[model samples]
Target chain A: MPIGFRAFALAGTLFAATLPAFSGTLDEVRKRGNLVCGVSMGLLGFSEQKPDGSWTGFDVDFCRALAAVIFDDPKKVTFQPLSALDRFDALKAGKIDILSRNSTWTLEREAGLGLLFAGVNFYDGQGFMIRRDNKAVSALELNRTRVCVQAGTTNAQGASEFFSTNSITAELKTFPDGPSTLRGFETGECDVMTADNSGLFAERLRLARASEAVILPDIVSKEPLGPVVRNDDVRWYTLVRWVNFALINAEELGVTSSNVTEAKRSTKPDVRRFVGVDGADLGPKLGVTADWAARAVAAVGNYGEIYDRNVGSKSRLGIPRGLNQLWTEGGILYAPPIR
Target chain B: MMVSAYPALLIRVGIPAILVLLLGGCGTTIDEGVVTPGALTERPATIRNEQLIGKWGVASYRDEKDRKRVEAQARAQCRLPYIIAKGPSDGVMMHLADDAKLYELRIKGGSDGKTYLGPEAPPGEWQDREILSVTDREMIMRFVDPEVHGRYGTFIYVRCPG
Candidate 1:
């Protein structure tokens, strides 16, 4: 065989060898008496540690929703905070059952890493942030400027594509992680910083002089962040995917935590189906209790509630629900029917 | 539209008495703490244009985390003044000096017998707020859609008499 073919064959063998030696992650989670969730070390609104050392944010709520469905208790889960470099490793090595970190779902990550992205929870894109005093309205004006970016991230590729397409040549100051990258930009090591728009907003809060910087209007690349699970765990993958869809469907159907009990009594066919009051066996299909979706909603509320609380207009980030809103509301978020 | 019919039925039964009470032209005030007889239902109260036509300042805007950073930004921008003006139809228009476009909102009666200020577009397009109290000196509003915008809680606006 040719060299290229030999290399491909070897990679295929390695991939097959790395497939989970054990089946049914759900079973293991049950035996352990708690689900292990992997999350970011700290990113405000998405996932962050409170003063009391408790976890909170959009991503954190997702894990709680999963736990609610499985154990009927949102607190029956433990969070293992991991940095960007180790998050995937932790998930692949079985140290975590579900990775609810704000990881971008990409073809390489899903196919190459032998992992599956359940669904996009937060729709994001890359953007730039500069000093407010710069008075630059457009990103094109940043020619010959220095940009602070984290290495080993899509930010590096996105920045390169943006600068090249805009025909601007600037120095790229790279750091190992998010904190160092933000620090470099804060200390004047770079004129601008680039990251997912959501991340830039979160990191801005950590700046000593946060009021001095402004995120630009330009969004250059797509970043659909979601939960990731091991490949071939068909039952587990289906369960995770449906939990996300249930939350989204709850938002569309107006079945919030505060009114879920009332919603269960709704005469609407859609609401009844989602609330498990229409005699649908959705939970049985997913290997959970009959009121799985209802419990999840009661535990963490619906997708809209979670978003508003953690990242939307109601959150410290004040990030608008632009592309994250439901399709009926002019956004791309849509879920298949439960029926 | 189907859900709207319920509110219309409520209006026929409740508005006459409230309108009679407000004929004095002092503007109707609905204290959120006081539950009116009609408040047994969930219909919103109707607000008159006279109550909202004035200049106001931003007192605060809270988020889920209750951080005050964005509120401070809004406060600085309000220094230019926020104005509520009469618009075409029953809709009211607000123009924040810094914003380029006019925001059109409508006052509707809720089952709670409280007036709410919601966007002029279709329902669920944007979050609505109840006019908890509106006076010559101060006005308070609370988000009607708690599931979507409740983290902001009640927004307080003091009359900017300058």
Candidate 2:
């Protein structure tokens, strides 16, 4: 056999060897008694571990919602913080059942890797941050300015493309990582910092003079972030996807944690279906109890409540619900109906 | 055209009464809380209300394979036609997402030059469904709300042969 053919054969063997068995992940999660969720190492508002060894943030709450659906207990889950390089590998190896990290859903990631994104949980994009003192309102005004971005990330490429396309002549400065990049921006080494808009909000809070920094309104790239599950198990995938949709639909239907109980008594067909008073077969189709959505909503509240609690207007980050709001309100966040 | 003018007059007199009925009938208002009132458009609907009065075979699909299959399926559904009844006003009777009962929705013309079917609210509102294409034989429509669109997909309405 030729060298290329031999290499191909070897690669095929390795791929088959690494391929997980077709065992249903939902069964495994139930048998294990806890859902092992993969999250970011330490990105505030998205995911971060407190000194008390408890995890909390937007991503963490999503996992908790999953737990609520399955076990009827929001705390019946383990948070495994994974680095960007290892997150997919960890998921593929079956170390984690679900990755609720703020991972962007892309064509390459879905097709190249044998994983699937459940659904877009957050609509994010590349953005710039500047000091309020500079008084620059838009990224179009950043010509001749110095921009600091982390090396070997999509943000750097996004910033490059945006500036070139718009004919803005700005100096591009690269740092080793997020901390160093923020340090560069803080120490006057760069005039503006670029990252995912969510990261910009999270990082701005880290600044000593956080109130002095402002994230611009311009979005340079689409970064739709969602939960990830391995493609081998359709049942588990459907469960996760519906959990997300349930949260979003609950918000749309005005079923909050405070009023989900009252909503159970609602005569409206949609509300009745959502709270499991009607369409009892819907949850069974997903291999769960009839009132799965209700349990999840009663535990974590709806998507809006979870968002506000973690990263939106009620949080310390105070990130406005620009694209995260319900499609009815003004944003693109939409979910499929339960029925 | 005179038939269309009569319904327009009825709409002017009938819509507020229907709104009041909807508001009063439901103990728990599902859609009223979140929908922010906006300026209603003045653009005339491209498709007239009279055009949708007959029966249609309706089916929806999310993927291409399903689209081809559902087009034929929609045509077959003409055996038990989905009636598009004339409303009490200048609208047609239709169902919104998860609606137990049909509603009298207006054929609103948007500033973007698209025709929409929804309640007498803003065009492209959550309850609205955009009319993608329409002809004497068939019509295609989809929900403006992403959630509804994700679930129900695009609907094809094939006109039932007389």
Candidate 3:
């Protein structure tokens, strides 16, 4: 076939393929009777399977919140564990309604792949971990140190850029994957090991002398991790986006699962709007019931509750809030008004 | 002849009218209420302290239906008006989020062309309050800090009748 005819044929095929999804993912999910959520195979604190064959983690709670919004029951969801390489492909193939894995919202991933990141649920970044005995307070102190990084990952480049920009010279040692790189660090092959700050926290739990190693406070790259959906469904995209915003807004409004019942009776307009006593149109506008936000909050609590339960001081990982803190409290996290 | 002259008439009268309508559309677009992303780059907006320094009635609400009732309540408060005093500096005296003491706040402009009233920091800083809409008889403001916004909601000031 001629090149022009082939190009036209591909365009026509693409248009036809996307036509059905544009109608909406919400209707399909409703008909299916459950939300199909894509998540990691197992990443502790973010997403991990328990002994009971049920999934639990920060990412898992987001899907639960979505399920609550749709079905008014958090349990109305199926977790589809996916590898990093196949995550986007699975979403594109219509295998999952939403991907709640700790995937970075990068320009290439959104534009190149036909996907849209809902909103940044967690702000993560490349960070280095070193032995506390080294007495290094920051990444800057690791000048001329050997840094272990996973091969074929962005951590090596992030480490190199940080060192070069700060006028510090550090040698980067590569390992095949996260476990081997961590092993290399533990066996004294390198002075430092680098990955995403979240990954470092998860890996540190597996360390022989976990308390002996410390994750440096410095973040070398911007990694705004969020839930992703296919770009075809605008209504579903809006629904997912606001579910995240609703969680953040609930935290801002001082509404929690414990006090949500009391909040419904509050005279305050914003509180009333949040608890669904007011702004009855808001939920239906998102293709859910009037008390969708209230249900989600009751199911998973607010963003702060989710963070504290899964990853923050309350969790085993015990990661600091850092940039994940609310914008009012000197952190960058902010959500637009519900009204 | 009338048909031929219609084009000339359209050029003379309709074009300027269309221009006016387009300009009016642009005016409403300025306050789309999209949050300004980063620091302000344009020059700070000039809101004369004299305009704000007056005895005004103040009330707050999150819902639109409560606006009229709150406006009435604010007007009634004019018996003992909420005062906005001229600061020692060129700015007006106002309280920051979670602050008890009043500080001098300037009218800062964002690159997106929205006006904010806050301290010396950038517009949309934690201390700043974006001027949602302001006029001679009424001025509305919302806190830039989400915590403060959550707690206080939007504030409305109605000018006390002389």
- Best-performing candidate as measured by DockQ: 1
lDDT per residue as tens, model 2, A154-263: 89999999999999999999999999999999999999999999989989978998878999988889999999998877889999999999999999999999999999
- DockQ score of candidate 2? 0.01
TM-score of each: 0.59, 0.63, 0.64
Extract clashing residue pairs from model 2: A335-B147
Candidate 1 to native Cα RMSD, angstroms? 20.2
Q: Of 2 and 3, which scores higher on lDDT? A: 2
Candidate 1 structure quality by residue, lDDT tens digits, A1-339: 122332243342233244434346676677678888999988778788877777888999999999999998999889999998999877776678899998989999988888899999999999899998898888888898999999988889989988999899989999999999999999999999999999898889789977788988777899899999978577999999999999999999888999998887899988888888885687888988778899999999999989988887667676778788999997889999888
Q: Highest lDDT, which number?
A: 2
lDDT (tens digit, per residue) of candidate 3 on A1-339: 122332243342343344533445798789779999999999888788987889889999999999999999999999999999999987877778899999999999899987899999999999989998899988999998999999999888898998999999899999998889999999999999999999999899889878889998888899999999988778999999999999999999999989988999999999999878999998999999989999999999999999988888777788888899999986789998888
Ranking by lDDT: 2, 3, 1
Cα deviation of A85 in candidate 2 (Å)?
Answer: 1.9
Candidate 3 residue A308 Cα shift, in angstroms, is 1.4
Task: Rate residue B26 of model 3 by lDDT.
Answer: 38
RMSD (Å) of each candidate, 1 decimal:
20.2, 22.6, 25.9
lDDT per residue, candidate 3, B1-162, as tens digits?
Answer: 001111221133688676756554233343534434475565657566677888888888888889889888888889888788888877898888777898888888777777888887667655688888878888889887655675687888999988
* Residue-pair clashes per candidate: 14, 1, 0
Specify the poorest-scoring 10-residue window by lDDT in model 2 chain A: A1-10
